[model samples]
Target: MELITTVIALGGVARCTSLYAAGFSKYRIALAVAAGELVRVRRVWVATPDADPFLVAAARDGVVLTCVTQARRLGLWVLSDPVPHVAAKPHAGGIRVTKAHVHWAAPLLPRHPNALVDPMENVLALVAACVPFEQALAVWESALRRHTVERGALERLPLGGRARRLLTLANPFADSGLESFVLPRLRWLDLPIVPQAWIAGHRVDFLIGQRLVLQIDGGHHVGAQREADIAHDAELMLLGYHVIRVGYRDVVENWPRVQDLIQRAVAQGLHLAR
Candidate 1:
C-alpha cells in the first residue's frame, strides 16, 4: 500500500526500483501488477490506472517532463501550454518521440533513470536556459512562491550564466508570475516598487513610487473578482493614488502599450501624491 501510494504521489507513475528503497521488493510490486492493483508502465515502471497521460507518454518515450510542462504540472502559473516539453541527457541516443519539444541538454543535477517528472531544480534550470527572460522569470518566481526550492539552495548549485542571473532576481514575496513579469520591466522608472503591498485595505500587485499602483488582473474575465478589483481601483483613486489596471493579456501580449501607459502616468507626476 505504501509503495502504491508513493507511485501515485510521484505524478501517478514511478520506476519499480524506487519502491525497493521503501522496503518493497520487485517480486511484491510485480505481484501487485498481476493482482490488478497497479499498471505496469513497462518492465521497470508501475503506475495507477489513472496516471497522468503526459507522465505515461513520457515514461513510454523515456524522457523526463521538464520546462513549462513540468512547471505547469507542479501548479505554477505558466504563460501558455502549447507544447509538452521533455528533456534527455545531451547524448541519450535515439528517442522514440522527437516530435515534441525535446531539450537535449543534461540537467544541472543528474536525473534518475526512472524519473518521468523532472525535479524542480531541473525544471527551473531548463526554463531559464530555454525560455525568454520574462517567461523564465515568471516560472522562477512561481517556484519561489510555492517554496519548491529556495534561493539559498539554488545558489549552492553550479548554475551557468543565465540561471545564476535569474537566481539573483528571484523574489519569493512575488504573489504571481504577473508580478514577476511586471516589476522587473518597470525598474527603469527609477522609483521604488513594492509587490504584494497593502494599500487601500487590499494588497495591490505593485506600489510604484509613493502612490502609483500597478495591477495585473488574472484571465478570469468579468465576475465577482472583477467587481471587487474595480471597487479597489476607485478606493485607490479617492485616496490620491494613481492606479494602472491591466489584464493578463496586456501584461503578456500587449506590454508595449502597458509600458507606454505607465510611462505617461509617471511623466504626469501622478506617481507622487501631491
Candidate 2:
C-alpha cells in the first residue's frame, strides 16, 4: 500500500495501478483483490459488483481505477488489454492514390500575402530537403499554378529571363512601376509639341520625318498657346511643312483616326522627298 501510493503519485492515474499489481504484487489473487477494491473508491463510477471482492474492496477505499471500458467510451486511452482483441478490416476501394507532403522555408513564403503556394516553393524546399532538381521543376510549376498565380509570383521565384518576360507581358498592369506601364512604346512619336518650335524655335510633341510635324493639343494648349499654334501652323505651311494637329482626346480615344492621318502625312512627305 505504501509502495502503491508512491507509484500513483509518480505515474499518474493510468500507470500507477498497473505498475503496482504487475511488478510488486505479481498476479496473486489476494493482492489483486485488495488493490482492485482500493481502486474502486478512487473511481466509484467505474466500480462494479461483479468484479473480484478484493478489487471491489480497493475501489470502496478510493484507489484510482483505469478501466478499458470507460477509456474506449471516452476515446482518451490507448493501452493494450490482456483479453482477446479483434482488429478492424480494411476498406476495399477501387483504387487509392497518395501524395507526399511538401515543406517550405520561412523566407520563401509567398511575398504577396494573397498569393497561393506554388511549385517553385515546393521544388526549392524539396531540393533543400535533399530531393532532385531536374525534371522536378516542371512538375513543381504545374502544381504551383494550380495553387497560385505562378507568373505573378516571379519576383520571389527562381525564374529565367524568358519566363520573366512572359510573366511581365501577361498582365502589364500588375506592376505599377514606370518601366512597366508608363513608358512610351515608340519614342519619337509620343512626345508633346512645345512653343519653342513655333516662333522662338518652339518644340512640338512629335516631328514625323522632315516634312510632317504633329502637335497633340491638351487643356494647357488653349488660350495663348492656341493663338500661337494657329499663327505657327501658317508659318510652317509657308516653310513647306505639313503641320497636322490633333487634340489629346483624339490621340487617346480616337487613336485609329490619328494613326491614319499620320500615315497619310508620311506618304505625302515620302512623295515630296522623291
Candidate 3:
C-alpha cells in the first residue's frame, strides 16, 4: 500500500524521485540514517554502507531517486575535475538532486548481447533537457528513420509533455505569433468542427458550436478581398450562420477579449440551437 509520487522540478521542467523512509518499521532507523546520508552526499552507490534497503528498492522500481547516495550507487559518472555539480536543495517534502549524467544501464540498456547500442533514450533525454521541445522532436523524428520510435511512442515516456507540446505548437493552424499562448488555452476548449461541405467551398478559420464561424483576418484577408469578405459574410448570414471576424490585432494584442468574445458567441449559438 505504498503511495509514491514523482517529484517534478520547481518549474515542472524535470522529474525526481523523493525517498520516504518512515513506514518500514523493520528498517525505520536505518532508513532515516540513510536518508540523512543521502541528503548530505547528493549521490551514492546503492552498495554504499549507508544505503538503505527501502531506498534501494525504490530505485529498482524506477522511482525517481535524487539523493547522492542513490546516484553514486546507480553508476552515474562523477567528474574527476573540479567543476561543481549543480545541486537543488531539499524542500518541504524531499531532497532534490540534478543528475549530472544519466546512466543508460538499467532499463534503457540494450538486452541482446550482440545488439548495437541504443543511445535513443539518453540522446532524447539530453535533447529534451537542453533544447526547446520542437527542436528536440525534430531530432527525434529524424532519428526515428534509422530506429523504431514512432510519433506517438515518445509521449509515453517521462518527457512526454515536452514532446506533446512541441507537436501541438507545430500545427499549421497554430498562430505563429500566438502559438505558445494559444496552444495551452486551446486544450480547454472543445475543438472547432470542420465543415464537411465547406472545406473546399470556403476557408473558415474556426467553427464554434454549429452556427458561428470565427475568421482570423490576417494581412492576407485585406486589399482586393475586403469586398469579397463583406460579400462572404452576407452569404453566411443568409445561410443562417453568424460570422465573427477576429483581426490579427485582436488575436495578438487583446487575446483575452477575443477569448471572451468567442466564449459568449458559443453560448449564444448553443442557446439558439436549443
Candidate 4:
C-alpha cells in the first residue's frame, strides 16, 4: 500500500529505483511489476498504465514539463498551441527534443532528479519568456485565480519588465483568462466593475455599476450549460439587470465591437439601476 501511495502521489509515474528509497523492497517492486501493476519505461523508470502519456514521455526524454504545456496540464487557460513545452537544466546537454519546445532556462526553484511535472514557479517563469505578453498575462492571471501561485510570491522574484507588469495586473478575483483580459481592457471605464457578482440568484462574470452584467462564454459552454445560461439571462433581465453575454472569442478577437456596445450602454445610463 505504501508503494502504491508513493506512485499515486508522484502522479502515477516515478523512476524504478525511486521506490527503494521510499522503503519498498526491490523484490516487492519486482513482484508488482510482474503482476502488471506498473509498466517500466526503461531499466530506470516505472509508471502505472494510466499515468498521463505526456508526463511519461517527458520522463522518458529527460525533461520537466514547462511553459504553456505545463500550464494547460495544471488546468490554466492558455492560447491553443499544439507543441509541448519541456525544460532542461542549463548545463545539461544531450537532450533530444525534436518533438517538444525545449526551454533551457534555469529554474527559479530547485527541481528534483525525477521531476516529470515542473514546480508552478518554474512553469510561470518559462511562460513569461515563451508566450506573447497578452497570452502570458492570461495564464498568469489564471494561475492567480486558482491560487496555484501567489501574486506576492511571484512579485518577490527577479522577474523581467513584462512579467512584473503582468503580476501587477493579475487579480486573484478574476475567474478566468477571459475575465482577466476583459477586466484590464475595461479599466479605462471609470465605473465599478465587480467580478463574480451575485445577482438574481446567479454569480455573473462581471457586474459593471449596479445593473450591467457581462458573461463570457468559454469554449466548453455547450448543451446543458448553454441552456442554463439562457435561463439565467432571462431571470437577470426580469430582475432589471442588463445582460451582455458574449463568446470568449469576442473578448479576444472582436474587442472593438464589444467595447463600442459597452460604451453605448454606459452612455445611455444603462449601467445604473434607475
Cα lDDT for residue 105, candidate 3? 24
In terms of TM-score, the best-performing candidate is 1
Which run of 10 residues does model 4 get worst, by summed lDDT? 167-176
Candidate with maximal lDDT: 1
Residue range 105-151, candidate 4, lDDT tens digits:
87888899988888998898888888877788889988988889987
Query: Against the unseen true structure, what C-alpha lDDT does each candidate score?
Result: 0.86, 0.39, 0.43, 0.86
Q: What TM-score, computed on C-alpha atoms, does each candidate reach?
A: 0.87, 0.30, 0.38, 0.82
Between candidates 2 and 4, name the one with more favorable lDDT: 4
The candidate with the higher lDDT, 1 or 2, is 1
Please give, for residues 86-182, the per-residue lDDT of candidate 2 as tens digits: 1111241322222212222333333321111222433333322332221223223333334433544655676545344434433322111111111
Worst 10 residues of 3 by lDDT: 5-14
lDDT tens readout by residue for model 3, 1-274: 2211111111111112222332323243245336652222223212233345434333333333222222223332211212112212113135332434323223332322211122345344444444444344444443443343444655566554664565444333332323323434544766555422262257665555567776667677677788787788888777777787877678657889888886787666641333
Model 4, CA-based lDDT: 0.86
Candidate 4: pairs in clash: none
Per-residue lDDT of 201 in model 4: 77
Q: Over 4 Å off in model 3, which ranges?
A: 1-160, 168-200, 270-274
